[model samples]
Target chain A: MTDDEVIHMEHVWTRFGENLVHRDISLSLGRGQILGVVGASGCGKTVLMREMIGLQTPTQGQVWLLGESLAEADARRKQQLRNRCGVLFQGGALFSALSVFDNIAFPLRELKTLDEELIARLVCMKLAMVGLGETDALLMPAELSGGMVKRAALARALIMEPEVLFLDEPTSGLDPVLGEEFVGLLGQLHRELGFTVVMVTHDLDTLSDLCTCVAVLAGQQLVSYGTLDDAIACAHPFARDFFHGKRAQRILGRSD
Target chain B: MLASQSSAETSALPPLSPPEFAVEDGTAVVHGHWNLRGLIAASPDLRERLCRAARRPDLEWDLRGVNVLDSAGAFVLWQAWGERLPERISLRHEQQSAFRRWQTGGIPAVRDGRRPPVPIRRRIIAAIAGLGSHLLAVLALLGQLILDLAHLARHPADIPWREISATIHETGGRALGITALVGFLIGVVVSYLSSLQLKTFGAQVYIVNILGMSIIRELGPLLAAILVAGRSGSSMTARIGVMRVTQELDALAAMGISQSLRLILPKVVALVVALPLLVVWTDVVALAGGAVSAHLELEIGYHQFFQKLPAAVPVANFAIGLGKAAVFGLFVALIACHYGLRIEPNTESLGNETTNSVVVSITLVILIDAVFAILFRGVGIR
Candidate 1:
């Protein structure tokens, strides 16, 4: 395990009955570093980050977080570590019954002991950080548009002021203009908070602009992992096809 | 092996690999290493062949020559009769070791026999555990309620009486008329049934005593509680389940709000406050209906029924019945909320649990009534 690493997956293998989704895969995330995991739909990038947050246990391997093995963490320790690692789910998993203010105030209420006034102020700040106005706080989840809901969800995830954030398909349903805006907001949040960000996305255009490091998942392994420049410089067919939007048939010179 | 003969006949037949079965004298015999994956791969063919051979009435699965089987393969053969094939495909075992393994709990993945699988033995244990968990949750909520009420008692100026009154009206007052009607019908039934036996003994006056005692002591509170359990209990559960499915509970968890305090405690407190009043109302209406029935059928005078009613059911009877109502109300509210909040993502679970909450609440109410009867009788309070 590296000293500065926030996440470490050593020889991780995950399986679902007869299907093996990941096999002997290993990767690490250093402090304040952003790792963009790019893969096709069934390649198991989401499961890797889920392991990092201790949401899933590897079938055959170990997951270590901040120098402590997650396998051995007690409930209290696990809760604390989970509070430190915030997650924004793929479909903007906001609580539909709660107003945006309650959504943003949830993590603070769960893990911190702050006065109501302070919680209100912090909620507004977090909301404003995501480009959602103060007036948007009282609206329920169903009332918001797709982009606004994502912003609200992001605000909720960051309520604890976590040291690391996991975003799954952050730009999944948004148009390009709003998707790029969300990425820019993430960039600003990273610049200000200096927290490590791990994003699992199929959107390859995000790699050059936002991600510092990229890992391409194929054949149930992290086939190539390094800086974006390294990924571009590599000659693997999967990475080449993914980054350039080359169809599998064009790259392989034959259709399957 | 039939592979050599078939290979000569057709070149395109994919050469039947190593594990082959040969037909000799109209009987097929197979031999090879049998692993779970290989057996699963040939399941379609095995199922077709088994169905054809086992079409006879009272079929027996002859696994005498089978070497080894895993849980999946065993279940496929075992479950095919009831689950898939539906005819008489009984599993017959002449081997001692295999029979012993089957009897001695070698099976790992057998489905529970109960449709919803609330096993009698396990449900008894779960009931005890569920009771303990409910008691703990109640104690915690009651402690908070006590603290809040104490604070309100200390500073009456901060109390929101209008809001409290509105909530009470919504939860209790609106339900009062229906509760009274149900109690009145129960009282009429009790009086009518008692008059039947009392007329033969020429003890018609005692019909007044029976109706007054049963309604005030037992049926009034019990019937009203069952009705509420069906109505409000189900409503409470559905409300919580919808909130849970929508991730409102997750939001509450995130915001650091104790869901028990925010959602359950207030509703429980409301029902607790309302149930005793409802029992009192129901008792009055039921006794009036009993008096009407007694006057009509038994030829007992209205004045006589009224005069003997107070003496028959003492004030202590009403008090004890109200206490039962309080406990029953708490059980109904807690069970409904618990099951509702525990709903998984499936809609089937929601529907089933809503029904289960009503059944469990009513069953517990009756069981607790029996225990209370023993306790009250022991204390000479009856």
Candidate 2:
């Protein structure tokens, strides 16, 4: 069942100053699965993503992205892996100076040596994939709505049609409706594009609806990670409460 | 609907009106006014239809009288604008500010908290930045000398005499008046002090020796360098530091450029090369004033003062003084570059570093002067 492990971290340890934020963590992400990491604020979700993206080095462990250890990879190989893995930072960290088109085109430009005509075509196509079209391309980051910014960030992440997509709190500030829609979009992209998705969020609604497998970070380890029904069936007080909170919405089908 | 509310009662709340929208001369005029709670409860159809009309191929939003909008309301208007409006489009009423709470693409009432962090890497960079300045100055001077030698070796005729004359006029002749004024005041102070102390010993003739030796060996170079550092070094730091904070340094890095080569190298080279010449100019003027002061106050004639001066100050004094000035110039440039590149991206950091740079540079200059004094005395050059 090993479908070409896209990301593998064996006994990873990350320490900031004197505090060990992530310790002896081993995680493997397969090619076409959605992995959801659920944790409260400051639970080292972003730190984990940083290690995956090769922005931070682990204290003492190994990390492999696309079959190559990130530490041992040459500059060209590292860049190639980075291009292959797209990251959507929390707060939709779109470069404010660039137009929406250029924001999506940033990775494309950085990676591919394409002419302007080809770049424009690719940028438009990516925007359209995120339910944004050619009309939304020329607007700057400051000119897009929150929903649009999220969409643009998504488009930017998918511009290279990356093998893996990492989204950090993609639905933090959004309302229930928009948040649900954003999750739905993530689901659609995953199904259609078949890119491995690893999302870090704390929304219970997202966990129940969108996630195929859920992992909870508590007590300094993944306390629970399984299919929603399987995890709910576990006889733990915290797990029971978490499942009940999610069940209240689906059975009642009420906004309240 | 509320639990007790009947169909008629719920309907009586008020049937929603049609969405009103208009576009004229690149300006979008969306006309809708709903109270806070009403829009929150209203259907999305009217909002969506209105947005579709406003979302013109070539138009901007003019949300002048928007009464209230939730996330849904904001999204509708945003969609209508076809998302092409520049940030200049704004809502006129105060109530609209409330609507912008969760919106994007326009001026939000609360500020966006998306500014990139001022990288701590810059502070870590300051140690190397000092050495960078010195190395750059030496490199620039070597480069210029090499180019001059190359020209002379290749085709000496290309070195125009007119250009050399112009350079002298700008560097020496144009600078003479200010240099004389500064040097003369220093000379008067030295002469006046020597006269005060020497009247006890009846050795006022030695006042000429004191003025000549001190001005040539130390005071002239130190004073000139301090003045220039105050005038130019502070300015260079402020300019570079401001640029650094404004993301100009980041821009340069992104462009794959060496900010030190582009910014630090030139200023360091100019100051180090110019300091010795300014010292020599200051020495000449200070001596002129010393002769005038001796003649008027000490009863030693100008001719007598000049006659004794050559014997009092050896060639070693001039050499030691110029050498000290060169070192001081290097110190000023290094400190300025260090502080400039160390600037964090905020006005507070800019102001603090600017003040710190000036104070630090001057203190280092004085400390360096003490070191020079010790070294020169040890070498028997003083």
Candidate 3:
């Protein structure tokens, strides 16, 4: 874990009773990079994401995010850390009772630094940033299609313009067309926003088109971490099977 | 890297961020972090920068030597470009996507206008429409249940005995502790108050009459029904609501399983059988509390109290109370299942339906009890 790195996990072990989700896992992410975390089911991908964002404390290791130790921080210090990051859960997890506008504006309102006018403008800007029109803001999460919900969640995630963004399965449940578009949107946001992203996903097209690096969690550890090609070439069985399998070949054959 | 930078006396070093412009005469030099913090720092200068850049004749822009550029920074530059990209900007290969996003970003030009705030009349109409659909669903469910019951009536051995037993264990067995505790408390309070009044008239023994009639004829069934409604009724709603939310109900329909017979009927039948017994148990527990109070306040022995209880309230009131318990139990389960089936695929609706089920069940129990009282006014009152 280097000082300038945006997120660093040093021997993180997330354990619940006898089950060790992550065992002595170490990884680091630099600023302005998008890292895709992929694994087979039950590989603790979400748990690792939760650890990076200070939501889950590592059972026996340190999690450093944006130059501060997340697990060791006080509440005020943690709030400062939290302010620099945004996380989108798998289900969009939008407050179902709130309108899309209010959901996007929630973090801004919580900061209490921006006026209502600026908040409204920024909310609209965020909605537009994720390809949502102005009129989509008034609708509830329940009214949105699955793809729209993901985009709306992405907008809310970006509303704060966080330094580090964590998206859990950003493209899952979307159609091929929408998935492609969403990945394109992500790549655009990564460039313009300059945020270090950690996304737990299973979509190969997303990794191919957008991820600057990939991390594979297997055997209860970060079996490999490097560029997508590096991961594909790595000899770890899980990594090899994940990135060089028949399905991967079909996907890679089609992408730029 | 920064820490390793040597302190220099003669610094002819390159500018950290001195973004040059093709049309230097008019095009503004964009510099520094384009991140959230950078935009926040530069927000105070937005108007001055935008106005000055807009008034300039030339609009050609360049981004070389810029330390960092983010969406927030790109947005500021776009604003300076009059909210549209110029013919060209000197963007590095890596910055191409960022620039494209800025050029295309903002509220879409064409949009369906937001609907006006729903008027009160329209909201009311919508609510009524929702209610109409819900009522229709409930009616359909009732029909399915009746059909299932008819089928079972034809095949007496086809009763879902396992599920009925489990429901009884859950709704009836698990709930006995709380019911007994609450019933005993209510009994003690009533006996204490009535005993005080009766003692004032030197008619202390009459406390048995007051406690017996009220406990058996009214309080016992109501108390048990309310307890069951809060305890079991809420669980039933939550269980079915989850089944709906998770599409388990749909899966059952797809599998050709009779949900009414397999799911709804067992709950109703279990409650119908268990609730009357619970009411009797509550009556016994509550009368025990009253007898204790009677012993304390009036020096009446337990035997005397038990012997007088039958004469004081009569067996007919007990039978009437059990009948009410059955009806209350059936209605509570129906109401709970109705709300459960209505749950949407959201946590908010689960909570809302659970609350509605409990409230509606308890309210219906009281309403039905009131109707029973009026309808059978002279039947149970000796």
lDDT per prediction?
0.71, 0.68, 0.82
Taking all chains together, each candidate's TM-score versus the true structure is 0.44, 0.43, 0.86
Model 1 residue A228 CA deviation (Å) reads 2.3
- Which 10 consecutive residues of model 1 chain A have the lowest summed lDDT? A247-256
- lDDT by residue for model 2 (A1-256), tens: 1327777777888788888777678878778877788655676878887888898888888777766677776787688578667889887888766777778777656644444544564565456557776556766776788889899998888766677899898898888889899888888767655778888887777776777777666545555667766656655555556555656456425333
User: Model 1 over residues A49-150: C-alpha lDDT tens digits?
Assistant: 898889999899877776557776678767757866789998778876567888777766654434454456556656656877756777767778989989
How well does candidate 2 match the true structure in TM-score terms? 0.43
Clashes of 2: 3
Model 2: share of native contacts present?
0.00
lDDT of each residue in B17-118, candidate 1, tens digit only: 222233344343433222233342353456455445434445434443444433223433433333343242223342332223333432222121112446
TM-score of chain A of each: 0.93, 0.88, 0.96
Better by lDDT, candidate 2 or 1: 1
Error of 1 at A84 (Å): 1.4
Using DockQ as the measure, name the better of candidate 1 and candidate 2.
1
Model 1 pairs in collision:
A106-B254, A106-B255, A107-B254, A109-B255, A109-B256, A110-B256
Return the TM-score for chain B, candidate 1. Answer: 0.61
Candidate 2, residues B1-382, lDDT tens digits: the string is: 2122222332342234433556677776665534222333345465566556554455566777554433334444544555344454666555354334323333211112123455788866876896686467546644654565465568766444453444334434555667779899889878877887888899998887788778988799888777766766677778888887577888988998556545555555556666778888898889888777777778898888888887877878888888987887776776777777767655556778788778877887889888888877855234
Q: Among all windows of ten consecutive residues in candidate 1 chain B, which has the lowest summed lDDT? A: B106-115
Candidate number that wins on TM-score, 2 or 3: 3
Candidate 3, after superposition: displacement of residue A232 in Å?
2.5
